[model samples]
Target chain A: MKNIVKIEQLELASAVVELGKKVGAGLAAIGLTGAGAGVGIVFAAFILAVGMNPNLRGELFKLAMLGFALSEAVGLLALMMSFLILYS
Target chain B: MKSLFEQFEIDLYCIIITRFFDVSITTITVYLGLLMVIVIGMYKVSLYKATLIGNNNWQHIGEMIYEFVVDLILEQVGKPGILFFPFIMSLFLFVLTLNVMGLIPLSFTVTGQLLVTFTLAITIMIGITIWGFRIHGIKFLNIFVPSGIEPWLLPLLVFIEIMSYVLRPISLAVRLFANMLAGHLLIHIIGVAAIYLMQFYFIGILPWICVIAFMFLELGIAFLQAYVFVLLTLIYIANIINLH
Candidate 1:
């Protein structure tokens, strides 16, 4: 079992709120792990497509960029959510 | 320990107008100083002829930037995007200046703030939407309504499209804001660690090396984030106008 530090002098309510903020912030950021995988997959596909057909590089790149932006938006949303959980 | 966010804390200098509008003088001063420098730099670069015939030293850099922006617009949005060359160039240069200035030691990163970047994104988005509407009229609604949708799936598809469209500005603003904030925070944290570890004889070197490497990475990111921001903006404009 992990050792848990307890402050005898401090009240329980405030300590709980403090702990909640940290844990909540982290929980919100869990979505980013999936987002990272999504982005990597998108770029990996992009590289494969470009390698196969040099002539399709320009068109493939635009699609890849669009995919990247959409994927990144998910990560940013998660980040903003975590910030909100921490502050509010 | 000063908290990691302590670096982002803004100290109010002398208020410019205290009664109705409480303006922070330091923020204004920094913005105006950067603006003046960018304006002068643009003027100097544009003054000389961009020709390989005569002395082509000073104007070469300007020509290169101009050509790059032009080519990027043409490549992304086709010939129609060339109409937005001036706006795109100015926007890229302005963001680039703010981003590079933030790298200066002891300088505030205004671009890193959500307020600044969100305002820019929202205003541009509003303008682009209005422009699209003006050009395409009610037909612009077609952007949300994909052709040949199943009767039952219409609502679901339209809802998803509208939601994604609404999230565009938020995505654009957050991307740059988070990147810069992370870079600056990393640099500050490493610097602080280096200072604290300096008490040890040999351990300080590792943190110092990290600090230097991170600074170089941050410097590259400063330029790259600006480019990404502009490129995305161009893409949005093309999508809006072309509706493809």
Candidate 2:
């Protein structure tokens, strides 16, 4: 459905490489959508927990943080992969 | 000025020629060395005044941080973790300072570099593994086994546990690296957009507002990520100590 515009400076070989890199990077970025959902769930649960027990907010915040880091780690791994694909 | 991406490059300053080897000094070394100096100097100059209860402004701030970290360790790891107070506190301060310093205009972000974070994570992981073996002996391997698991499913669950355990260091390093890199890159793009839009002179406010909001978010994350790293380190150590 998508097209790569033919540029005068880009030869066939270079174009193929570029196309592959872009595709690979795009695929890697797809992982971010999942990360987005994961982060949303982390904060959502955090808020829900705080709402349930107002006094437990302090303890819950730390748990939320650990959860955030774990979920964000998954997403960041994907982002790093994309970065590596594009830059390297 | 270097291009946005080019700023991440590590330019060599000078090479040290010892009798046995040559060590290349670069921007990373400079920043890390500066970070070390700032962390050590800040704590020493502030806390060394009066050991019991110094009334210096920086001393009060340092004590507040010390109390916060102490509470965190006590809450998470309990009595055994008191011995690691200096290490954990220093780790938190070092990362917090590094992340905050990166927010300064035109300064290179040390944590944004994958190699630096990976080295930190790997060293911690290696140390924890060694410490686990030392304390728990063969019992440390019990960490991979769950108490309620079915006998037939033990192998499968253990494999999953071991795999996740091995991935911890990689995840820890990449999380910090990517977060720092993302914050910097987003700020750069927004900044450029804000500047360019100013030529038109009206809509520039939108990007500037976004830039300001993101800066605040970056500040919170600067603290959050450092705390997360230390907290996780403690939890891992706690697991080793309790073999749970």
Candidate 3:
């Protein structure tokens, strides 16, 4: 009975490692929520700027894309961090 | 269940030249196919002159891609950046082609591997660092130091700047690698789910639909990530050259 009970008990170190991965990845993913909202704000402001002056579309678009890439990079960094925690 | 990473497995061919040099047949075949396409396409394009008259579809695409790369270079690096046109254009095409090629069923994505993307990133980083030093000489070290900074904050800011600068290749490589890896894994997972769900009648259609939707999304991402990679490269190069 004691042997079966010991086998049923979870290994503490492995459990902690598993929990840490989930927590780390979850914390890292919090950045994506911010990123998503940030991206939405970027385009929203972009729309407002373009609406104010249609002629600025090309210039604004270039900046918008650059901004988008930079913002996406941050999100990707978070994703990479989480993957590192999970995999490494 | 099969491992999620099984898609990334590389099997060697029977014809091994040496113990240290086992060739991955899938990677070689994919790259060779890409080279053949580029060579044939370039040859076809070279057959026609840049006439303002009616252009064929292939020539039109070729010119458009060329113009786009030129515009990107100019936008970031201005007139001086035109020197990198060939290198940037070829890099963009090669990475983009490999990414799109990965979309095809039963094909390997070279960029999906860190070894491939990391090497590209490290090589470009080294090349750009050399170019920066060549242009600015000892002043290249000034890249770590921001201009018009307060004396007290300078040390911390410089340290952060140096750390971020050093992390460029890693971030660049990881961005491409993780994006491709996640996209491919998602598609495969959804695909396998759909296959398993086929045991049910009406419910199987849902995952199948998701698989199709994600495939299309992945296709767009393949192009977008390649563009982002090239754009970031141009931005990095411009930062070094302009020193601002």
Candidate 4:
């Protein structure tokens, strides 16, 4: 009975480790660098827009946000790569 | 780091596998897969041979998809472009399947990968170029020359046209890749936001509504992108063939 219990514990531990590795690899693949850069750029653009005119800031920020999403696409490639590495 | 834009990882399940075989081998695989599906389907059809084609659900749906592709090609590329029907139809269906597959929770969106989109774009570009040259002979070079241009401007116009021609595959690949990637990411963001919002308020009502709205929007986008990709391909081929 004790041996069976130990084996079950071992299996559960391995499973958890496998899941962690999968998640880590996936996270690594979606490169955070490009997204970080995109966010920074968008933030700067928003600040500049706001400085120009506070009233237009909201609309300009929304547009900037869209541009930011487009720019972040580069990071998505990395994300895919990580997933491939982890899962495949 | 706690910002709404915090980076998260996404792993795709599909990976491109390489073999020592040539591209004809891969094409053969696709052909065989298509044939196998048809053969198996034929067997299934035989079992229901007594039923008229339109009376069967699968047959009707299959014919509808076929007719839709045919109509799209005809509408976009004209009659002469019908020769390209098989290639365009296969590409459209394959990409559409892959794109939609990604929306299934935990399934990989193969089209979201640059390599897949780029390969498709390159293949279409190469195939169209070869077809153009084969049909037009050396006159295919005339594609770079604008008619009615003065002799003095011919050289400059050709240069610009050549650049544009070279950019075709890049633009084609980028358009599909951008659309797929952006749409998926947007959906992901909305989903993540909804999760976070659910934690804060009984505003469960609004979050669910937004989620459902976004789901439909993504579905529309998924189909739209596929249509746009295939449509542009037909247009590119039409341009190459100079079909009216």
Candidate 5:
């Protein structure tokens, strides 16, 4: 029984590595939530701007899209980091 | 279950012996060849029988793409940007085609590869940087400086400005690569799940339905990413030209 208990302890050490990988991956994915929030903030500002000045829709759209792309890029960077952690 | 990542594996077919080197053909080469033919053939077939005022749908699409690209350039870069029409149009079409090609079942998504997207991005970055230098001389470096800033803040802002400037190409590549990779991986996971679930008779139908919905979403993303890439490219070019 003591030997069996010793083997179980050995298994736990290796299992910790596996658990850490999964835990880190899960933490990395939390960045997607930040991304979601960033995208929401961007679009919310965009909609407010357009609502106030409909005529500026054309110009505002260019800026909005630029803002959207930049924000989305940051989100994707976080995602790629998590992806590298999980897959690599 | 078969590993879905098996779809991304590149298997070498054969190596061709050149005078100086060996060229090994792989899965990407085959798909890239097919993609080239498809894109070129599409333009040829569409415009081959185009009628000016007739209901030629394909021609209309071609023209619409042309007009849209032109409008995008004009809006962002003004008159000067129109010079980049060919380059921008080709960039949009290629990225769009690559994304759509991935949607076809069992095809390799070239855009999903970082090497491909990053090379294109780096090429654009270097080319524009050279272009900026050529047009404005060393003064083009003025781009790293904002107007009417405190001298103390200028040094800090310049460092930040230069850092962001250099990160442009990397951001451009990662946004596309990650978007394509994650999008395809999502679809593949759902598809495999659908297949496995369908083994349970009527219970399988729901996952298959979910698969179809995700397919549509993937298609929308493919187009949207392509447009976003082109839009961002236009903005970058405009910034370079106008230096504002």
Candidate 6:
């Protein structure tokens, strides 16, 4: 009986670890996916803004492009951090 | 009871596989998977008689990307750009595809990984270095020396230029890797924030708004980052080749 109880506890522990891993992965995916979608929306808006204002078009376009790059940097950083967290 | 979100903490750096040498195979597999899709898509378009007559979405998107890369090569690298076209186009397409793929739910953002970006940056640097030597031979060494400089400052200028040249891959890799890493993190934070703030109905709106705003911003970023990467590569190659 005691041996069976110990085996059950071991199985529970393994299950918990597996669950933890799944949760961690889920969180990372959610974060990156949202960011990717967010970036797309922002770019579309920038294009619309540029269409509206002819004078600010060139400068705004450049700034918008830079902003886009910066945002992508954030996504990459998050991805790296997620991996670090998962491994270490 | 605790919220569902409270039960989960994202591990951004989670390894899919944890073998030392095995990592290379995994990385290669990811790259090959990407290539397979691209190649298959191309094949389908070319093989289908319908692709010739009408504007299919996939074909249009592919062509648009091709034209954009060509424009980038022409504008930055100039007329001799043909030689570098394949590399630049591949780099741009690969990065662009990777970024867009990251947007898909549950898909891995291959570009978000340092290994991938560094590999690409190193490849570009090596290619340009080789091209420089091939075209200029021993004169390629002159790339370190600037014109219109005082004779006394020649050594200092050359030293600085060489250091800068050596730093190219580092900068290129960091720029791409950092951007992708940061963007994903911001989204994760916003997502967590939105969930946490939702306990208070009024406060919930602000987090949602922020999330919405950032989401749109990231979309533009996906394209711009790819463009900047290719643009810098072209500029670097142009410097090496002295095409201007």
**Top candidate when judged by DockQ against the true structure:** 2
What does chain B score (TM) in every candidate?
0.89, 0.92, 0.89, 0.79, 0.94, 0.82
lDDT of 3 by residue, B161-242 (tens): 9899989999899888888887898798888888988998968478877888999998978888888899999999999987
**What ranking emerges by lDDT with the best candidate at the front?**
2, 5, 3, 1, 6, 4
Across all candidates, what is each one's fraction of true contacts kept?
0.18, 0.65, 0.41, 0.06, 0.47, 0.71
Model 5, residue B15: distance off in Å is 1.4
Each model's lDDT: 0.82, 0.87, 0.83, 0.70, 0.86, 0.73
Which lDDT tens digits does candidate 6 get at residues A23-57? 78567756667668767977988989878887888
Residue-by-residue lDDT tens digits, candidate 5, B93-137: 999999999889988898999999999999999999999999999
Model 1: per-residue Cα lDDT over B207-238, one tens digit each:
88888899898887777777788899998999
What is the TM-score of each predicted model, taking all chains together? 0.83, 0.90, 0.83, 0.62, 0.89, 0.67
Error of 1 at A32 (Å): 3.2
Worst 10 residues of 2 chain A by lDDT: A1-10
List model 6 lDDT by residue over B174-226, tens digit each. 78777666666677777787888899886648888898888777776777788
List the candidate 3 regions with Cα displacement exceeding 4 Å: A1-31, A81-88, B14-36, B39-54, B203-206
lDDT of 3 at B4: 72
Clashing pairs in 5: none
Model 4 per-residue lDDT tens digits across residues B85-113? 87887787776766666677644566666
- CA shift of A46, model 3, Å: 2.8
Model 4 TM-score, 2 decimals = 0.62
Among these predictions, the greatest TM-score belongs to: 2
Query: Candidate 2 chain B TM?
Result: 0.92
Q: Would you list the clashing residue pairs of candidate 1?
A: none
Candidates 5 and 6 compared by lDDT, better number: 5
Question: How many residue pairs clash per model?
Answer: 0, 0, 0, 5, 0, 42
* Candidate 5 CAPRI-style tier: medium
Write down the RMSD of candidate 4 (Cα, Å): 13.1
